[model samples]
Target: ISLLQDEHELARIVADMPWSKIDVNGLREQETRIRRQIERIENDPELGQLQTELKQLNQQATAENRNQYQAEDDLDKAQHAVQAEQAWLDAYGNDDFDDATLSSMVSNLLADAYENCFGASVRAQDRPKLIAGLFDHESETPFHTRALRNIVRIARTRIQEIDARSNQLRADTERIMDDYLNNHSTDDNTVMASVEDYRYFLDELDELNMLVTRAATDEEYANSVKKLYMSFQQLNRALRTDEENIKEQLNRINSMLKGQQFGPQGGRLSLDVTFSPIDRQFETTLSRILSKLEDWTRNASDNPTETRNAFNNCETFVNRLHNELDKIHDTNGIKAYGARNLDPRVRSSFYAIVHHDNAPDERISSTGGKSGGALQELTSFVYGAALIYLLGGDLTARPTYTTLFLDEALIKADGRYTKRALAVLPRLGFQIIVSAPESKTAEILNVANRAYVAYKDPSTDNSYLQELDSETITQDETQPTTAPAKPTTEA
Candidate 1:
């Protein structure tokens, strides 16, 4: 029974084993291929031919082998001769150096040679031949030999003179450079190092020119230029202070805006700026811009470039400061009014809170509460007045058409708040036209210049407006009426 149980377990394992489908016909085809390959090997054509040739070669081996050394020697000699002829043909094939290129090279060499011979020079007819002779004396034509010798003689004399002048010039340049460095940057290691860097830049620029000119293709030239650009950029990285400058400028502006003291009614409106350095990962780009501005500012007068780079830099700094200030929203550490009535809409508005004398440091959500409501209304009134002040000129200095059309004045406010709003608006240079219920009409008319009542005429079923004088409004009970009713004298 145990053996049966073990067999059953083995059967289960086999059943669970991963298996793949097999093609029976494909296996049969592979077998047939193997059989055919075996048969072909047994009757190989090349093997049969080699076997036949082996027998024939063995019979003739002694005779042929006796002359094999001599035959190989002759064959080697013939092969060598063929190789020599091919090499000669290849050596004399179409010239890689074209006439135009040769002439241009010779002209450049002759120009230098002439420059060395004289302080400044002109090209000669024999210059190209003279240079070609120096390179290829084996092919020196009899006609050019005299000119070549004369050129060599002249070059020898000129080279000595040029070497002497070059030594003197080098000494003078070294003296001048030393004097400038000592005078301008003797104590400043940083400035001296920068001067050294400028010298290295000039040296590298000459090398870059050589590299680009010698490059065989446009692609090669472009790559060389890119490499030089990258090398120059390394110096830029060392000299950059854009991030620090920007930070300093922003901090200064923020201090000014924050510390600015306003007169009695400025309402503590101070702008605060905060910077996230991480967001300024584009410091490299900013550095390049600032670097260009610095360069332009330095050479602008001499180079006929615009001198407004200073102004541009100032503008950029101010704009960046503005952006940083914009990112920040002011929050005051005052009381959170209307705490009980904090709704979702009110909660979202908690991003910024207002503080005034009455509701100092109160959450904007407080606007929906009892005392908060009055403050909120007052805030709205002040905000509208501010808009008018901004749109118009200064109220005290110059008069403007400062008119406010208010619909439903002091909505849901009591008499005291209504009366206060009416009193404050006019003093702020606002002529308010208020449309409200008959109850608040009396309060609105107290400060209004000309009051008008809009009503629907019952008989005509059309809306019509009629102006009302303050006396007429005041004569009708303390509150005003939309329209006066007819007198019922007979009744």
Candidate 2:
């Protein structure tokens, strides 16, 4: 009864447990199977090998974790170092700092520091040492400070040389200024010496330079004036030569007309040439200018006062010429002097003067009030004379043979006037060839050396020339001479 009570208590405890609902048999079986697996693992050879490999892999993992930690620490340290260097560079770098500029700044700073550190004992060899000491913590290599020392020394030497040269120049400038003041001391031009300051000395030097330049310019102007004066002299000589030639030509023409008599009253003809009143004035002024220019050139180098006076006179004449030219409306004015105004035909008035025994002297201009017959006779004389002048070998001697063509000449003249006209050209040394109609043929044949009659053939339309006998047209011997009536003048 005691054992039964114990069993009954146990059953009651089992029922009151939390896992009392579980199958106790199934749990026992799963535990048995897990036990069997654990036993197999303990006894297998490949399992022991896997365990050994796992042990080694864990050891390797531990070592790899330690190496990774070390690597991360090293990377952090390296990054900090790069950042420190970048920050340092940023402290000194600037946008304006190119390589040359930055190098100069660094050199100056190092030189100053070197000078402060060692003072007079700053040797070239010690420069690199100083550079290294200053920038030892920097990543870049130090500068070659020996070259810097040499540059500084050379710069200082050059500065001293410049100062010495400047002093010499100042002394030379003072000496030259004193010399100039002493030499150029004149009553009209007084040079003051105030060279105490360098700038004042430079100012005085500049003034002297300007004066020298002005003197040179004055010399050049004088040379130009000389050239202009020489040109005027040449022009004057040419004008004189042309005038002489014209006078000679007129003389020749007049000599040819001296003995030749024309018209019923036995009148003589002569040509006259003269410049207009304004042209004469311009010529006179030009002569005066030439004289003044001569005086100026003669005194230009030696006498300043005389040169100035002569130049002023020339200027006055030139101004007068300019004013006159401005007033002239005609292009044929004195401005055209050498070309057109000087031409005898353009500027001068021509008159055919007839001098007779009883009549007053009559001037026949271009618009003459004279009979055509009388004018034609006079024109023949003048034309003959001009031809003789143009045939320019020897004025006194006649040519061997020179032909003068008179086409229908003396057609308007009477028989006496025609005979006189025809006789004049032959006397002036011309072979006369006359072309006159049958009406005047008798008078023309009296003077013509040879004659030919031209006729055209109507059938063939061709022209033919035939010589005619001089005896065909004969002068009448019985024609009585009578005193010519007074030649009527045209209204």
> Model 1, 221-322: lDDT tens per residue?
444333433543553453344444544543432332232222223332222223323224335445655565556535653332244333344455445435
TM-score of each: 0.28, 0.43
The local distance difference test score of model 1 is 0.53
Give the per-residue lDDT of model 2 (tens digit) for 1-491: 99999999989988788885778899799999999999998999999999999999999999999999999997985666566556545754454534565567556755565465444766766544444444345574434355456556756765788899988987788788778867876765444454456576576786677667835445445655676677667756765566557667788889888878867777787876665443666678788788777666565556656555555566765665457455435564534433343344344566767788788987777745766677777778888898787784667766678987777766787777788888888888888877777677677667666777776655566766667673532322333466443222110
Please identify model 1 stretches exceeding 4 Å from their true place: 1-376, 380-382, 393-396, 462-491
- Clashing residue pairs, backbone N/CA/C < 3 A, model 1: 334-361
What's the true lDDT of residue 84 in model 1?
Answer: 51
